[model samples]
Target: MLDLPEDKILPGTTGPALQYVLVADEAFALHKHVMRPYPNKTLDIEKRTFNYRLSRARRYVECTFGILSNKWRVLHTAILVNPDFATEIVKTTCVLHNFVRRRDGLNCNDELLTSDLPTLPNCNTSRPSNAINTRDLFKKYFMEEGKLEWQHNFI
Candidate 1:
C-alpha cells in the first residue's frame, strides 16, 4: 500500500546523493532504494557484523513506534474509520508524540517498551542487485569506520 517513488534520492548524505532506501527485514525484496539484512544462516563475519549493526540502528525506529503505539492505544486496535481519517489520526499522533517527548523527555521505561513491543511487518519482495550492492557498501562501512566498541561482543 505504500506508494513510494522509485527515483527518490535519500537526503542528508554528505557527498553525492544516494538513492533513498528503506531498511527492512529479510521478508522484503531489496530494490534500488530499499536495503534489507543479508539473507540466510551461512553469512560470513562481515555480513553478520553488518546485520548486527543494522539491527542496532533499527531498534531506535522500533522503539519510537512502540512509544507511539503505547501512548496511543488506538494504534493497537483496528480502526473502523475511513482510510483517510486513519492516516490523519496516525499523523496527528506522531506530531503529538514528538511534542510530548520533547517536553517530557521519553517518560516511558525503555526496557519495558522495547522488549514488550511486537515486530512490524516487512514488505515482501525480491532483491535487486543495486540494493544488494548498497547494502554491501553499508556493511563495509559498519565493519570498518562505523563500528562501536560493544559491537564485537555481538559478532
Candidate 2:
C-alpha cells in the first residue's frame, strides 16, 4: 500500500475525512486503507447499498485488468520469473497499456477478459475495530448525502 499522510484526503460530498482506499472482496481481510463489503447476512439497506457501490468499483478494476491482460498476453500465462522480476514486468505493462490507451483510446475489439485463478480460503481473522468504524462512516455517507439515484435499485 502507498504511504498516505494524515493530510492526504479525498474530497467528498459529505463525510468527516475520506481517505483513499482499495476495494477488496470478501476473501481478503479488512484494513483501514482497504474497504470490503459488509457481511452478507443481516444487512440493512445501508450495508446493501454500500456493497453494491463497492461492487461497481470492483467491476471497473476488473475491466481495467481485462484490458491489461488482453493487451499484454504474457499476463495471461504463469510468469515463471522471480517475484521481483514479475512485479516489474506487470508494472512495465501497465505503463505501456496507459500509453497505448492515450494514443489510441478504446477500440471496438476490446473485450472484458477474466483470468481463472485458484481461489484462496476466506480470511477468518477478526476485523480491527477501527476498520469497521471507517466502513460504517462510509456507509452512512453513502446512504445520506452521497446516495446515488440508481443505487436504490440494487438495494
Candidate 3:
C-alpha cells in the first residue's frame, strides 16, 4: 500500500481518509479492502440481490481478462519468463489493448473468448464481521440509493 497521508481523501467522499478496494471473486479472501460476492447458495433476498448486482459488475472484469488472454497468446500458456518480466508483459498488453481500442475502435470479440482456464476451487473461510457489515452496507446502497429502473428486471 502506498503511504498516502491520512488527510488525502478520495474524491466525492466525506472523510479525509479512504482506502482503495479491490473487487474480486469468492475464491479470494474478503478483507477490509477486498469485496467479493456472497456464496452461491444464499437464500436471503438481500444477499441474492447483492450477488446479482455484484455478478453483473464482475462480468466486465471477467470479460477483460478473457479478452486480454485471447489477444495475447503468451497469456494463454504458462510464462517461462521471470515473474517480474511476466508482470510487465501483462501490463504492457493491457496498455496496448487500451491504445488499440481507442485508436481503432476495436472491441473484444466476446463470442471467441473461451472459459477454458481452470479456476481455483473456492475455499470457505470465516470472514471477519466487519467485512460482512461492509458488504451489507453496499447491498443496502444498491437496493436503495444506487438502484436503477432496469435493475428490477434482474431481481
Best by lDDT: 2
Candidates in descending TM-score order: 2, 3, 1
Q: Which pairs of residues collide in model 3? A: none
Ranking by lDDT: 2, 3, 1
What are the Cα lDDT values of the candidates? Answer: 0.72, 0.83, 0.72
- Superposed on all Cα atoms, the candidates' RMSDs to the truth, in angstroms, are 4.2, 2.5, 3.7
* Residue 89 miss distance in model 2 (angstroms): 2.7
Over 64-113, each residue of candidate 1 has an lDDT whose tens digit, in order, gives: 77778888878877778999999999999999878877887866453324
lDDT by residue (1-155, candidate 3, tens digit) is: 54434433434444334345567887877775678887778457777778878788778778878878877777788889988898799899999878877876765343447776578887677788878767777777677666666776877
True-vs-predicted CA distance for residue 146, candidate 3, Å: 1.6
Comparing candidate 1 with candidate 2, which one achieves the higher TM-score?
2
Model 3 lDDT-worst window of ten: 2-11
lDDT of 2 by residue, 94-149 (tens): 99888887788766367768766677788888889988888888888788777888
For each of the candidates, give the backbone clash count: 2, 0, 0
> Whole-model lDDT, candidate 2?
0.83
